[model samples]
Target: MSMGRARSVVLIGMEGHLIEVEADIGQSLPAFVLLGLPDAALRESQDRIRSAAKNTGIELPRRRLTINLFPASLPKSGSSLDLSILVAAWAAEAHVAGTAKVVFLAELGLDGRLRPVKGVLPAVRAAAQAGAETVVVAAENAQEAALVRGVEVLAAEHALQVASYFRAPGAVEVPADPAQEIQRVTPGSPHAEPSAGGEAAKDLADVRGQAEARFALELAAAGGHHMLLMGAPGAGKTMLAERLPSILPPLNEEESMAVTAISSISSGAASVTRLQRRRPFEAPHHSATAPSLLGGGSRIPGPGAVTRAHCGVLFLDEAPEFPRSVLDSLRQPLETGRITLHRSAGQVTYPARFQLVMASNPCLCGLNVGSGTQCSCTVAQRRNYLYRLSGPLLDRIDLQVQVERPHSAALALQQPGESSAEVARRVAQARAVQTERLAAFGLSLNAEVPMNLLSEQLRLPSKEVRALDAALDRAQLSLRGYVRVLRLAWTISDLFLKDHPEADEIDAAMVLRQSAGVRT
Candidate 1:
């Protein structure tokens, strides 16, 4: 009973490890010592803990102090353990006599102030999952922890307050209702606007008219297809890509969590203070590297732009400006819908099922035969630049649009074209139709419709079907491209409320597929 000892769980990133805090009080020795492979930050906790306990009017036991974070094999990191270690030592020194009902998870400041700890939300949820009953955390992080239902959390601002709560019984003030804060929701939605990777949250109305371009954007979202927009510098390429998210649907609960998880692990990036509501919109600069685009690092591997854009849109303006290798790195995630960051700690796979919207010029000079201006770039330079976007990558893009400068009339005729909500209504309908069609096969959208599904399940009418066969033969469309066109056709038909693509839809889809050829 003379030994000062308490136990708590230590969280490292998303992982949790149980730690034992033991104290031996004797007249012989008067010093503090911590063991169990503590890192620099954890080791320095000695000063913070002592100062915090003293400020809270509790004396630090000077006899012999020992702390042990169990599962000694798992590397212990961060200051989330401060609360637990403090509680354990206090309970032992005060001789609480068989007290064992609560657990602590927080960081303590030397001033006795309770500070918010990173990844505590994940840790609190993990505790509930592991069947722990009571969790006490920093008052600052109560709201985040409260999101995990059925877990009773006690939040305190100072060490003194936390100690008082355990010694007595009272309704300690905790996080308030987060819902009361009015959020800038995507139009017509009853949810908060998401920050990390989201639907532009911007509307299509701001963009001058590009009727065909807007149509292409709708088709891209409907079919779950990647697109390439080629035009001169002044053309509406970037605007169209930005508006792509407006037509796209918002993320579901699971998708939101997946996005939050990757954002949480991003190095040098702070954890998301709240769950994002809108779909993510990431437009990395032309200077991004392959590893930054995908995922890799020296100590802890984190998700790249591709994974960060999971369940959202990844916009690459000046697409060709990105190094050939960087642009090519996306090929895997496009097909796999996930990216794995291989590190010495092991590979961490993050979800990357995002819609790709890429924009590039028709030539190196930013002008070409299609540009309203004269073409001045030499053929060799154009060829070299175009060649960079070879078959391996071009084959993946389902729709190719030659975005052009808006006509004066179109630009002036902004009669409030459409809000993200209106277009989202149609896109959601098309997605629903695709979901029903592919339910048995577990596919979500037309773009994901495998070649086998086209040939075997959703076969086209014989006459319209014959047209596709002849067209593919003459065009030499690869098997993958063939599937892509059919998927696009299905989406076009769905938009028009048709059960299947008619001959007209299939023809139109293929033309959109092969239009403007490659950007080169």
Candidate 2:
């Protein structure tokens, strides 16, 4: 028996494993065998590796090569393990040794060039977590990997280049970041539109003639509350939803990384860079499936639109038209700030801490009490239309505002309101105040205040506390609803520069909570 050894790596979901690739060479037959519970994508890596080996001028022995991926029962998926497997098979067959120092991961192109693989950022992080010494990956993913500290990383363009690095460590030069050569980027947008840099982002200023709706939106952003907008078809409800993210707070470094990870798990490495700069704006069609909204399928469970919109906005247009079950699925996440999908294989938890911005017509006919249109649907039809939105779902929503169609005079007379940047500054101020006020309790935003801690941390005077007690008793608010109102009251006070939400703050917030909201 002649023994040859080679080393290689495989990237699992947001993690990297140093795989033991052992190749046992025998003279019985020239057949190749791979013993590992690899998924279909990985099963096909043999051809890619073989072609890349031939193109890179690596000779394969004309004898049986039995390759084993150690941690034998662990499920392996994706072609990312191809390079590691190839190297391991070759090393064992060629009797190569002392490769344990280098960690290698990449997909091999037929031309022998090293192509970028998915989850490279997470994979690199996983390696760092495991105290890996040195890591080599595709040149394209080097910049992302370099973000982590404590590990020496080398990126190369082709398989031979990486192999050469292993053969002579510290000899191969790591490429510098070519960001200047890359296009000038707008930080919030990943994909470049021809007019992206020049065009303006959708702003709150674009929404017009809906003062109450605007106030509701501000409160929602200020307190991280969910909002529901009821209006006629042409009332700019959708436009308002689109602009919510712009007025909200920007993501911090840690939040940005978490957001990018969710995106990465969705579309792989390319996803990591895209759709992460800005707060996610996901508007699923009314006809989406439960899995499409909540996440599930054959492989590992992917993040749903709600999870993607974490630390962002989930805009559900035509909200009442969505399947009741899909809409109801939101209740758990809305309260818990995360969703867990339990499959027989395992449970996948994703952050669902997002502001839900839902817009729906007041009635099935798209108009029940607004301008430029008359009510056509029967009373039952209108009631049934609104009925589709179950009470449990509606109750979870923190703020519900009715948006009326623009007045003929208002539409004709006004210019666009203040720009998004102008409003974002004010919103940022309110958020800062919340951060300061809650700093003592290790909290920032008002919405994060749980009821158990509210009386202690946000302790109000007896008069104000009694008013809240009366409101809760009269309104029959759930434990969740009571906390949401307190959060909203706090936001309203901050908006008006009040130190604490006094009786007036409570009153102003009560108007929004009243059963007799202005329907028109």
User: Best by TM-score, which number?
Assistant: 1
Off by over 4 Å in 1: 2-37, 95-103, 168-200, 261-274, 369-373
Q: lDDT tens digits, residues 316-423, model 2?
A: 999889999999998888888888887755566778888888888878777676442588888778778888888888776767777777888777868777677877
Superposing all C-alpha atoms, what RMSD in Å does each candidate have to the true structure? Answer: 5.7, 5.5
- Taking the candidates one at a time, how many backbone clashes does each contain? 9, 11
lDDT of 2 at 512: 74
Worst lDDT 10-window in candidate 1: 180-189
lDDT of 1 by residue, 119-203 (tens): 6655766677777676776766665555555667666777776665554223233232333221222212332122345333678
Q: Model 2 scores what on Cα lDDT?
A: 0.70
Minimal lDDT window, size 10, model 2: 189-198
